[model samples]
Every structure is written in structure tokens, then in C-alpha cells.
Target: MKRKSSKVLWIDAPDIKARIEHLVEKASIDWVHTERIACVRSGNSSARAYARIWGLNQVWQQVLDVPSYYCIEVLSEKFDHLPEHHKDEILLHELAHIPRTFSGALTPHTRRGKGSFHDKLKQMIAAYARSFR
Candidate 1:
């Protein structure tokens, strides 16, 4: 029997990082705490991108040894194929998951309630639109 490798390849793509920086500035969100953005090829196809509190787990920290408030992972193939605006939208959506507190933690989406993920997405879109004006 063959064992499946759990290791993921993380690529530092400056172009993607630049886009994230522009989006953060335009969103007027204090994301200076974000330490890194990397492209990853996930086995799951439905996932476009995601953000999470980085280095919070001691065991994983010992292995990776990087300190960061947030780590955004863009699914390599799917994210790369998107248009610029779509990429921005997806990245913005992931960033919206971070709370205003700027702590190294994630604000999980409401599963089935008033303040659902969709609500947050709508608010993020509205804010992004206002940033241009």
C-alpha cells in the first residue's frame, strides 16, 4: 500500500502578494499583521482560497517556524485561472474573515444565522466599492 503525502508545497508568488497588498490598502483594513501569502495546490477542488491564524499551533510552529497573524492560501490552479477582478474578489472575501481586532485568530462564518458568511461578503463588497470613491 502506498502512503499519501500530507506535505503541501507553498510558493511565494510576488504577483499575488502585490494584489493582496492593493486589496488591503483599498479595503482600508489594518492587515499589516498578515505575515505571508502563498499559493498552494489543495486536493480539494472546491476551495479557491482561505485565510487562518498562523503559527498558533505549537507543534506545527515547531515544524514551520514562522510567526504570522494570518496566512492566506490560494488554491494554485483555480486561483491562477481567475481574472484579475475575480481574484481580487476571492482574496477580499478571505480577508474579510479576519476580525477588526487584528488578533492572530479567525472569525469563523456564522453557519445558519443572521450574520452569515454571505452577509459578511455583502458588507465587504460594499466597503470595497466605497473605497474607490
Candidate 2:
């Protein structure tokens, strides 16, 4: 019998990192520690999302004996083909996941108050637009 398998490759994405830095600055995402964040691209991944945020939780930080850090991952299959504006939106969405505390934890999509995650994301998109104009 033969088995099928998939391979995933992760590589540092300095270009994406640079883009994120610009977005962070333009959007005034003061809560995020841009320096501590890392960006990586994955090839041949099965994830359906355009991008995702991976965080090192407090426990992991303690276990690893390191400070808080975030990894923004872009799946090449989904993200690489997107338009520039779409890519920026996706990047901002991932950045939104990092809570204001910058404690290496993710903020949930559901909010306790009136607005939702999309609401915040929309504001960010608008801000990103207004930035360059």
C-alpha cells in the first residue's frame, strides 16, 4: 500500500517583515512590539486562511526562558497570489491578534462589547488607507 503525505516548508520572510513594520507604523499599532515579532512564509501548507498569527504564551515563555514574541505566518498558497491591498489587510488582521498587553497571547474574534473583530479590522483598514493618502 502507498501513503500520501504533504510537506510544509517554513522560511524567514524579511520582505513580509518589512511590510509589517510599515503597517505597524502607519496604523499606529503602539501596543505591538514590532521588533520582537518575526515573519515567516510557509510553502505547501494545508491551511485555508490567508494568514495566521502564532504567539508564544506566557507559559511557553517561561519554559523557554524568553520574552514575549509573535510570529506572523503567511501561507504562500493563499497569500502569495493576493493583491497588494489584500495582503496589507491580511497583515493587519494578523497584527490585530496581538493583544494590547503584548503578553504573547491572542485576542479572540468575539468581543465582549458592541463591536466585533471585523469592526476593529475595518477601522485598521481605513486607517491604513488614510495613512498614505
Candidate 3:
């Protein structure tokens, strides 16, 4: 008998931008415009968390410097492993960071220096990630 290889569902840029619009509208923020979205292969040297943020920064600068660009860069390996529902959750969580970035209120994921909001944000993100699985 032959074994079947698992195929991961990928989220495209327009879908991501649409989701961002939904989240932003729900959050009562002004509209965000995106210029483009593209995926580039990542090297092993970078941390996944940091790389994700770096991808967001790339969008931020490319679209507009001042406006926060909602983006995600899943590890190619992990991207291949993620199920569809989990992808939705992650996209939403990453979009949640946009308002903070745009407003200049963004902070590191660390818990010690910040208050409950940041921690709560992380918790909610984790919850979202878990809820789909």
C-alpha cells in the first residue's frame, strides 16, 4: 500500500488582505491599503517568531512606512504542515497586531515589562490557535 503525503492549504495575499480589512473594520480602525504580497523562502538562521515579524515589517515598509502592514510568513516546512483552520486563526492573530503597530503602541511579546493587555493579547492569540485544533 502507498502512503499519502499530507498537503497543507495555503492562504494567498488577497485573502489575507480581505481578512485584515474585516478585522480592522471590526476594530473600528480606519481602512488599510495593501500594495502587494509575496512569499520568499526563508533561511534556517532566523527565528520563526522574528521572521514573521520581519515579514510584517517588509509589508509595512513596502506599502507605506507609517501604516502597519498586516502580513504573515509561516515557516515553509510548517506551512506545509498547517491545516486549513489553523491558518485562519494565525492570519487573524497576526492582523490583530496591526492596529498596535500603526498607532505606535506595539510592544515585544515579552511579559515582564508590559501590563495585562499585551499578555492578554498573547493569550487570545494562543487561544485562537488552539480553538481551531
Candidate that would win on TM-score: 2
Cα miss at 70, model 3 (Å)? 5.1
Question: For candidate 1, lDDT tens digit of each residue in 62-105?
Answer: 56775434566777756667787777888777777666655445
> Cα lDDT of all candidates, in order?
0.61, 0.91, 0.46
What does candidate 2's lDDT look like per residue over 1-133, in tens digits? 6446678899999999999999999998888888999999998787779889999999999999999999999999999999998899899999988888899998889978746888788888888889989
Model 2 is weakest, by summed lDDT over 10 consecutive residues, at 1-10
Better of 1 and 2 by lDDT: 2
Stretch of 10 with least lDDT, candidate 1: 46-55
TM-score per candidate, chains pooled? 0.65, 0.92, 0.43
Residue 105 lDDT in model 2? 91
TM-score of model number 3: 0.43
Q: What's the true lDDT of residue 62 in model 3?
A: 61
Off by over 4 Å in 2: 1-3
Q: Positional deviation of 84 in candidate 2, in angstroms?
A: 0.3
The Cα error of candidate 2 at residue 78, in Å, is 1.1
lDDT of candidate model 2 versus the reference: 0.91
Using lDDT as the measure, what is the rank order of every candidate, best first?
A: 2, 1, 3
